[model samples]
Target: MIASWRPGREIRYHTSLNEALANPAPLVLALDGGVFPFRGALERLLSEVQKPGVSLAYSSYETDSGTVEALPFNGDITERFPFGPLRAYLSERLIPTGAERFRFAWEYHARLALEEQGLFPSAIPEPLYFHAPDLLPRPDLREYLDSRQCQSGPDLAESFAYLRYPPEADAEFREAFYAMLRRRGAFLEDLEPERTFPPGKGENEVMASVLIPVRNRESFIAQAIESALSQDFEDYEVIVVDNASEDRTRDVVRGFRDPRLRLIENPPGSIAFALNAGLRAARGKYILQLDSDDAYTPETVSRMVSFMEENLGCGLAISYYQLTDENMNPLPDGVVKHLEYDRNNILRCEGAGAVRCWRKEVLLEIGGFDEEFGNYGEDYDAVLKVSERYEVCRVHKVLYFYRRHQGSQDAVQSKAERLNAKTRIRLRALERRKKLVQNRGNKRNTEGA
Candidate 1:
């Protein structure tokens, strides 16, 4: 319940978080169920919270496996609560009047907002507590979605607030989020019209190209290849760019005798490199994504291609996908569609969706995927790039199968690795959004003149 090296001071217990926040103490420590502070943990948190203008403070914590260093505070914290156990000193006077009416679901929601109110966060450089594995929250997509009490709205702000903290669907919170984004200059009134692509589609061009970037995914490569080859839509080539796989991944591609499936070998490099190489070789008007470890439904290519073809303004098309086991059995969550894919809020969430299809000419115009992202955030970077310049629409149908198995790249990433990747990606996106808002303002000014 307490650290061994605790400061010899009187401590009081409150029945709930609200009660603790209501206390008149200069500092308060809030811990998740079964969280045990390590030696000197409270001392560190207390020191941080006592600093002038500090609203909330946190230190890294240990789990069953290892210590998780908390991510450094940033604008990304607005949408995602990245801290674990934390200390707070946000008395009612410190918060803006009427802000309390929002009734945030977690103390984090209230504390994070204080940053905008001129308060700041502090972090200790090391682990301070032990988080019991059993007590940790593992929120499933389906369960979380079903539990959300918010209604659908055309405004991305409402959805953003709902998704960020589903338990508190306050209208005031949604408006606050919108105002925050507007203040950051990341608010967008509308997407720019589609930029004109180069003159014409190249000679002998296919309607679409299913691009598969692979490395040591021999087990799943064949199924992914088959899914692309068996698509209901014709006139599409399956371009499998092997990133110097040490396994039989290339050989499996060779077994598929379909001329429509072409395997391009590349020097061992990042997924971005492999994808750029495929993009260069692709002769399709549209480039569809098919990961080596994932498969698509027979109509995925058709649906995505049709949607893009019908809507010339759309530069990127994202379709819903079904979560499956390694053997391809459907997961309990079933279809995972991010209905929150507004052009503006694309900066808020993870991404549009899986089975993304891009306009080949638009991909060329944007210079393909940015190799700077290397492997981790190339797709996300691409999405952000495309969304900025043109409309990104969604298809409601389940067009892809996202497999949750050990071999999938995302399935094996450490929490720290994911956090680092996300931080970089989000920072880049935030900058891009600011620029978008700036450019829009400049354009309006010119038009007014």
Candidate 2:
């Protein structure tokens, strides 16, 4: 029995539970016009519950989507509500102000109480409301809430406690609370860290091989290895091609001692030469080229592999990356944003080049790197060649960190060397484009004659 009623000016409520189940709307389904795609919310609610229990629901609505499900309420209301200090004050102070305020305050309190009681259902699994796209909070409601003062000491404590303590200390408090609950056997198994990687067997075919070409990256090499090994995606090997580093780079690689780490020695030379060596020895269906100083997010490989799998037509998948300083500190937001927007343009200007994860077969067919322009712009050259024949995708997530340090080749290289490398890259691009045009012209001439 779904019925929609408009209360006074801006408030509208659609109640369905009471009418549907005269016995007890085990699930109280509420809807407001502000929520969009209200139908999807209804469908999700119906799908989540196979068995019966008392369910109290509320939703945050968008202007376009009808309602976004808020926390589900099923268990003890008291424990879930007023469970937190901020909520307690809201219940104690805000509710007493007026009936109009009480309705809004009660809704907020009810949601919190439901969560604390372990009655809050996952809004993701079952959306009970849809929000309209352009939905905005009423100005009157906003003004009313803002005008109310938080009462005395309790209010001050709740507001300032978070600011006073460091996040780690707050985390410790939360951990202790959860630990206590765990001892009482109330902890959910899903809350535990999930192990996605399986133990290595005798001869498991590696799914991907990560080739990291390094020179004197002794400081961050370990971090790079750790990031790669810590990936959620297993079945991958890290091939560190050492370009004759005079530093303790060997010591750093040796310390890890993971079977998945394969150390290849490349005498002090070009980035292209070292990468080509790694490519020759790589034994994976897919290949990822990483810089020794760069670190990857745990989900980087997983996301790349998934993207590649889904998009069979694409030969390479490249993601936007963040630029970090020597110590791996991220650059300013404006700088990062600009770099991301310019990545495609940068790749195009250098020819058919882009940063990407490539199929090993496609890479091998391209005859590996040109070894001529060894260090500075070799990656650009290889990517240009690959992109000529294969479809390349640009994933707009910062999955990799391009670390900038004084010792980096980009910094140490002379202006002449940099200009030379850029020239080499442009020349290579022009050559490839010329060849393509000639082939097309030849074919057209033959067909016309």
Candidate 3:
């Protein structure tokens, strides 16, 4: 297919390696089974490619998920081809051509290596391409599980979407590859021995504590408070950290005559600050997260607490949640399977726990939530820390309700800010990996001497 915006241009065609070789043009472009609506995509891509030290070039594109995706390119993550349609390659480097520069397996690493041989890969800000994941038949968890292709930790492998391999690769190979990465310290690694909490049955001290951090969420605060108060796990305490709510949130919370509801007021600041305040005052061994605008089912606390108690190694636990509209109406099939535990890309772990419940001591040990991250993506950073140091578990039950409203950060954060925040998160993970590698080297040297 020819990538052109001019009138009467042939934008669609089927070609083989022979046809591409026959073409006299220096560059060959391939598009998914869709039309290229972006006009300057080709020009902009070529311009960047022609730069003195540029190798492969790509453009940011919008995904079917209503998010503008321009994932930060990394060699390790490239092997999985998570780029989806965000990238295009030098045709000669692809399969059946010269060196088979690109493939379903090693496209990212090979092209990135090719760039390293000369100039680096280049990117443009335009949404040059459109690719929908639904266009292809992807294997669901059932297919992966039934295939019996996952011999190594099939439980975790099948749970995550990206880990589900096609029939081409056997279970052993994928599992071995995963083990190698885990050993290399890039993927999920257990925290140092000293970091784990003591294993004693320290009082079922307060059983569980529900932390609700809010500011100006009057309309929703009462429902959230009641949800916490009505949990089947009666031993739990409800600690509401009020962030100077000007709305009727304070009055509504005060209206609750329940003695188990502990309300602490803090100055107007970041949500992290309120969370920290609530966490500091929590008396329970485990903490349940309750946003002012979202609620928990009565069974949520009990179910999540059981999961954590059963999985002693897990530091934090999250579960499937029902996504409802502002009016509590069912919103399509928004079932969350917690696919964030990719074991490869840490970024995918953002949803490690949409509704998080952490071991109080472990949460405190990790320094709790960083007030520096402000309110946006604060939980994500904390989850990443927990995942780095300890295992994160996902309960298959829909124990929580997430109401998608206009006030939520997911609905209000700008595209640029989302990208920027994700980029920062990625950098942090990378830095953590670097430190781990250095520490491993130091330990080896010490042992040798």
TM-score for each predicted model, relative to the true structure: 0.82, 0.51, 0.72
- lDDT, each prediction: 0.71, 0.54, 0.64
- Residue pairs with colliding backbones in model 3 are 93-101, 94-100, 94-101, 149-171
Give per-residue lDDT, candidate 2, residue 271.
Answer: 88
Ranking by lDDT: 1, 3, 2
| Per-residue C-alpha lDDT of model 2 across residues 1-449, encoded as one tens digit per residue | 12222112121222322222232222333222223323344334334432222123233432232323343322321122211111111112112322122212333343433333333433333333333223346685334323432111111111122223355643443343343334333322221111112222234457788988988888889988898888998888989999999999988998887898899988888888888889888877678878887888888887887777776656667877778888889887612322312212333243322236877777777788788878787767766665556566666677888788887777889755665566567545545645654675687799999
Best by TM-score: 1
Q: What lDDT tens digits, residue by residue, belong to model 1 across residues 49-160? A: 7677677778787666777887666544444556664444444423343344444434445554666576777667687766552543455522332243211111111111
Candidate 3 lDDT at 118 equals: 59
RMSD of each: 8.7, 22.4, 10.5
Candidate 2 has its poorest 10 consecutive residues by lDDT at 82-91
Q: Residue 119 in candidate 3 has what lDDT?
A: 50
> After TM-score superposition, what is the CA distance of residue 97 in candidate 2 from its true location, in Å?
76
